[model samples]
Target: MAQFDEVFDWVVVGSGAGSMASALLMKQAGKSVVILEKAQWVGGTTCKSGGVMWIPANRFMNPGEDSLEQACRYLDAVVPDGPDSPGTSPARRRTYAVEAPKMLDFIVGQGVKMERGSTFWPDYYDELPGGVKTSRTVTALPFDKNELGKDWASKLRQGFLEVPVRLDDGMKLPFMKHSWKIKRIFLKIALKFVAGKLTGKHWVTAGAALQGRMLKAVLDRKAAEIRTGSPVSELIMDGDRSVGVITARDGRPWRVGARLGILINAGGFAMNQAMRDRYMPGTQAKWSNGIETDTGDMHIELAAKGAQLAQMDQMVGFQMSEAPGWDTDYVKPGTQSTTGKPHAIQVDQTGVRYMNEGGSYEEFCENMLVRNRTVPAIPSWAIMDQQYMDEYGVAGKGTAKKNMEKWLASGWMRRAETVEALAALIGVPPAALGGAVARWNGFVRSGRDEDFHRGERAYDNWLGDPFFKNGPNQCMGTIEKAPFYAIPIVPGDVGTYGGVVCDCDSRVLREDGRPIPGLYACGVTTASPMGRVYPGAGASVGPSMTFGWIAARHAAGLGNQFG
Candidate 1:
């Protein structure tokens, strides 16, 4: 039997960007800290993400140009207009404003290289009121794969690594071409990748980059350490204040004490069936909201000890393909929305358009459920024309044929010559389906989709190869093109957005809305600062990184002292 280690000043759970940042920050604050990550590999879901941190007035980008007041004003436009919302809660919003700069300073000043890769990636609703088009997105300087060294390689998940696969497979060509003019000003990502290899530049992806960057700073300083495959089974409670965690690894069970604080940066339930069924009852998912291991029990366990939970009902559900991860994702890249692609219109159970095809994840989800409340959801179909198949090449070859064949052969998709005939085959009321397409066509012709505003956002217009030079725009083929196609669309999500709420100090909150003693949480375990609107190009990662730094530093008692 392995002997249990005694105690550290702080202990963190989960290895995602937020949790890792916490561990790193705590260590920098001169407190002994240990990170217990459930993943065999480190980076968590962050490694699998696009790695953008939407920090307003961050030190790296528009340094000396941005301020807290400006960030708040920009946020005022989008943060849900209500009490009990992220924007409405002064304390929670303040938490982000105060610590965001510190997090950026600590991580970047420590040598985590960064660049503005998203000159073209606009806000989710850039064209909407109060949306800003530029300056919010940031990316890691291109990283050399060789720079991770051997220790980090096997631990990296392959699923999140697919972007490189597509790049290497010549998909980058289409991304930079006349047909795919999605980006007007390319960050030169492909060139950067090539240069990174040659120049020995090592970079992080999405939130993982932020997490990894922070971890590197602390590890170099030897302030904290992370132990993979160590899962905290229970909290070490000492008279109402949690003291340590009982972690099990390699068949050995033991307790690792936390002298000062224990923060659960573990993620939320996009993967766990119970939490998914409870919080987001209608969402269909196969992978995770963040990670497959992000079971909701961490809160349950803490709650057993009287830790109050907040916003258990809210989750970040985006539109995912019918097949979920990997195989399904091949039909469309993660960055692209389900709308205006080589598919059919997305309708709810009542067979009516519920959202703009180019909307963000949360709005997409909120609207989906709102529509579902009024109707019984049969699968929504993606109606495609044979001309669409031949001309556009069905999701650019290979992927389209494979998934569509599987769907058609499996009866999930049907094809016919007319929109009415195609709708009849799927049982979605031929007239309703016909009218929907006609309305959609009218929107396409006038270059104005009045119903749902298909090409409203700059992001959407860029993705569709619309004939007009109107940025990324979409058009319908009039099913008049014949040999129309349709596939069932079911609403799904990446994960939930709520958990143990915390303040800028990274302190967990009590039932009375007080920061709980010696406890903190980041990642999906806390209230998302985006306040129901995803602003950052990689919105999820920004808060995760910022909060991770906050939680870790505060837990290690370094919140005030760190440089």
Candidate 2:
């Protein structure tokens, strides 16, 4: 409601994880920066994620002790040059390959912490180039809610699970906690629910914890501020070198100048149906976990300022619960990120395995399109067994139970005490459904999935619990545990990765492949490094934050040279 103007050294738009990380780091470097967010809240979809930050060769990762090199080998074997990749040109990916450590070091050195998992999880398609079994995945130790300086911790957003306090570096929460009854769950959640009221040893949820910690550092900077409810309508370009942005901060327009560059950390086009129709047609918006503010306005506003778009046809799609009130259906209860493991099998309309059932969200969609004869890709079921659901608590037991009830009540759930009856309702022939289950059961009984090899890799079994049967035991759950239930599975996504083209340094390129001065983009707003592929856990956030820091550093004139 206030109309005023001020100039800063840099302007970062969209205060999501990417923007917040960039702004915090930029301010750490003594650059005067301002972050603008269109949403009423600051964290965006990140606050709702599972909260794991995947970084290879990170502090907790043991290259000599654990062998991250094996994983890198897997990734190189799988990850090709993503199309419209601005920075990952053979040169950029290679450069980024080397710089990743230092870039990581910069954040860690600046106070962002990290903790590597015992083993890294693959990005669904562990069989692909550059894909590895484990080690690059990491999490941050949880922050005490009290450490957030009261006001910061009190009113912040909440994730689905009760996050555990971690010890060590920057990585945060990784999975959802389940198995407890809904009452115990809610009681524990109630304590966290009144997060504002509790004081003792409070732990931060991953996405929010990560962002909040980063925000704490950002707010500490002199002349740096987080401006939410600010949506940039126009670029204040003096010629081509983007000088500032004219934004609407709570319906009041204000001009904030950027001395060096205006960073478009505003995220991607997942929430924008118009942009979805324009580039990634047939893609559903509700599947994405990206910021609600990421509706392509920043892309259009930036393009009007001379930024070219890239990777506009692909998105980071995942199989989400088609449950009501599940806007993006975040699989990570307390965190805003998914572990991205291929625990679920995506079958075609014929109930046949289509593509690699465990492909990354992006790869899943692209493969579906490439294999479009597999009609009904959009509404496909991510088939799983009752045992698997009971063990990991992924999607959480309470949410799943309620969701099952809702589905059963709304007729979304196809329930039959027998697999054959369920197949009839789902239209999958009794023989086919019964046969698939029988084969799957055989895999469970034999402890081997000869056909799909679901748990062949250590990554696929990440969700498996110790109590599960060993050998034929691994994650193989019997579908025979009736009443056999099938909640309608819908395609979900972290967000869309189709937007403006940018180089590795996060500078947007025009159609002519030259940098659009004063304009830089990262996160979903810029082309992703994996393109239509997800390399592993923390895939989108890894590049989004890494490149976001890269872009902010570049805008500050501290990073590498631009061609």
Which one is best on TM-score?
1
TM-scores of the candidates in the order shown? 0.85, 0.83
In TM-score terms, candidate 2 sits at: 0.83
lDDT of 1 by residue, 16-38 (tens): 76765665566556678777887
Clashes of each: 21, 45
lDDT score of model 2?
A: 0.61
lDDT of 2 by residue, 1-563 (tens): 21238888878887666776677667666778877777766666666555566566666665463334544554556556644454345545544455555566766665766656445454466556555555576655555555666776654556543344342211212222423343454455456547644646566656766666666656655425766667878787666677788888656778888877888877777788888878876767766666557688887887776677777877777655555445444442211111222223445556665543433455555766555543665555445555434433333324354356665676655667787787677776677667776776676667677886666655555534333444543344555566565544445567776677777777888878888787887777777666555666777666777777788777777745211
- What do the candidate models score in CA lDDT, each in turn? 0.61, 0.61
Worst 10 residues of 1 by lDDT: 162-171
Worst 10 residues of 2 by lDDT: 332-341
